[model samples]
Target: MKLRVENFGPISYADVEIKPLTVLIGKNNAGKSMLAQLIFTLMTLTEGYIPRRFLTSMLQHIRTTEDFIAPYLRQVDDLRKKIKEAREITHLSCVKMVVDMIIEYLTQYLNKTLGDFLERYFAMELKSLVNLYSDYTRVECAYSKYSIAEFTITKDGNLSAKFDIKMMDELIDNILKDEETNKLINRVIRSRGGRDFTSTIAAIEKIAEFIFPKRPLLSTLYIPAGRAGLLEGYEAVSSALIALASTAPLKGISVPPIPGMAYEFYSLLLQLTGRKGPFEKMSDLFKEVIEGEIVFEELKLPKSKMVYRFKFKDKESSVDLIHAASMVKELSPIYLVLRELVDKGYLLIIEEPESHLHPAAQVKLMEIFAQLVNEGLEILITTHSDILLRKLAHLVMEGLTGGRANANLKPEDVAVYLLKPDEKGYVTREVNILEEMPTFDEVIEQLYEEERNLCYLSLQREMNEASPRNF
Candidate 1:
């Protein structure tokens, strides 16, 4: 996929073709993080599954046919009364006739309802994108399959949206069919029989899935730069918030709003510290770099309050995660995700993996990243570490010669962008990789010039000391 950003944040213009392994290198505050967050938000808003709350709310309140079919049946009052009366019948042939009539009347209603829901869903997503990037007056994003969604905010603070509904209508017809609608009708009928509604809920869930397919390939996880600080205070702060929230209903206290990004990060931390999944085996590279495993412990209180603590486990002993080495805390979240959350074909956006890590450890981490890419995991990283870039260069070289073990990464698989700010605004330029190495010669040339100037100054000083003074 290609992402083009103009007049967003510090970026005046940038058009990047995302690769399997994309790297962004620049000085701090050069708009790299802004670009990454924008991509994450767009991918998530467009391709993610339907919101669980929206689906559950629709199912709970709109259970009976009367709930959604009422408007359509308002004029046909006698027919509606007859349909309600037919619900009490027991004979098979009579019931089938009533069901067939109801289905015939509800076909157009169901199609309209589903179509309106989809339009509103896409509209809501576009509004959210506008709110997230409010500074930019104009923004545009287009997916490979979906049409372009554009937004403009005028000087009067009025927002306008231009979106095409033609593709969405076609998608609805292909994924949601009349057969599924019939199944929904049957499930609703069964729900009215005093039987458990599990099957009905399941049927609704399937319909929702087809309408909003899960993002199989573009599944993403963002590991922010503030992870260390967040990890340190996660337990205490989260417990306090939970306790307060739990008592708010009883005490009549108002609950304040939490930042969305903070909430997402906290949720990720909780998942990491919650349970063990199928992928419990840590890879050899992770073991070599971390030298330990993550362990979660549960604590029970008198009032049925349960608190969880995260720790590190080695061959000798276990220690609290907060007190463990900085590198451990920095890398634990990533390890937990790869071990438990992700299986294959995921996009991982990491701000800086080399944070608080030794130079050697940083190189090792890049090697592991290469291995992950070979195993079908796409990565997007923003870094200022020359060491990490050099390590990647060496890996590319090794891959070229076929001398590296399990080194499936080639020069074509990687894309590097150098971000810098000029008088106009920030710009992103794709750096060329020649002979299996990145062209960072500009940086090297600057260093060489500085050294040469110092040498010239030293020689001039020595000559003055040997010569006689003119005073």
Candidate 2:
């Protein structure tokens, strides 16, 4: 997918092409996080799975006049009584003609009403996709295309329908005449099928789902850098609250709203504490790399309430996640999500995965990420760690050489963007990777120059010491 952002936060303009394993490396406050957040927000809003109940409710409200045939018949009966009192009509044929005219008029009106309702509904739904952008920034994301339904009333008093899929219009032209259209519309509106409502709705829903099936909603799990600090205090605060509540029954203690990044971290923490799933391989991998496994314990509180505490367990003992090594606390969220929440084809964004970890651990984490990418997980990371970058490049080379088991990520599979600031705000450029290695000559050269300067200073100091002092 390609994401284009203009005037968003610190970024003036950036057009980024996202690959399976995307890396953004730059200095602090360089708008790397801004781009990551933009991708997350867009995917969350546009491609997230919508509840079936919401769709059903919207469908139910789309009613046609034929669904209210009894009311129209009642109106006709009332009119007939009024006409009879005003003037006596001796001919039964004339009364039949008037009733037919009323029915025809009502059917036409209902068909137009149904058509209008469908047009407005479909248009409004399609319009919502464009509202993902903020006022200060313009964002566009291209993904799999889907069809939108269009309804039109033909000049011959018939209902016409079309499915606009990828600009290829599949027209069901003049599919229903006035009366037939009314009946069809009524069937759809009332959901009257299986000779009644249920089957009719089921069929309609099937068609709708086919044309606009849930767009492979990419589940984005973002592990923020502040998770360690949050995890430390979460246990103490929750335990204290539980203890206080046990003394006396508290009334109306509700969860306060957590804003911004805090909310994201809290939500992930909550998911971690909930039911654990079977991800033994991933759990074992975490243990192998981090030397510990995340263990959650359920505490039964008063009033039959249950709360959970996350802790790190080694071979010997279990420690509160807060007191565990900094690396363990920092990587706990990643382990928990991979073990329970994340699955194949989900997007996992981590901000500075190298935080609070040794260089060796950081490199090992990158190797794990490579394995994840090979196993169908899409990962995006923003980092300032050269260790992580070097590790990734080495993995690509190893994959190419067929040395790693089932790990094959090509250079093209990884996209590295370097974010930097110029005179005009911040801009991002894609870094070139040649022969399965990313080019970082400028950084390497700068490091060499610094080393050379240090060596020259040392030599000058030695020479001055060897010579006798002039004084």
Top model by lDDT, which number? 1
Task: List where candidate 1 sits over 4 angstroms from the true fold.
Answer: 47-136, 145-147, 153-214, 248-259, 278-284, 298-314, 435-444, 459-471
Q: What digit string (tens of lDDT, one per residue) describes model 2 on residues 1-471?
A: 676655555666677877889999777787887678656654454332132333354468855345444433444344344434544332232223333333343345434453333233222222221222223434444432333323333323245333233432231122122344334335533421224434333332233333333433436777777678877777665556556665544555554434445556666666664555544475566776667676665545444434433444445556656777878888878888888777777889999999998998987888788888887788999988878887777777776787767555687889888877766567788876443223356677888999999999999999898878934
Error of 2 at 105 (Å): 30
Q: How far does residue 348 in candidate 2 sit from its true spot (Å)?
A: 1.0
**RMSD of candidate 1 to the true fold?**
9.4
lDDT of 1 by residue, 63-84 (tens): 6444543532342343334434
lDDT of each: 0.61, 0.58
Clashing pairs in 2: 191-197, 192-196, 192-197, 193-196, 193-197
Please give each candidate's TM-score.
0.66, 0.65
Q: Give the clash count for each candidate.
A: 0, 5
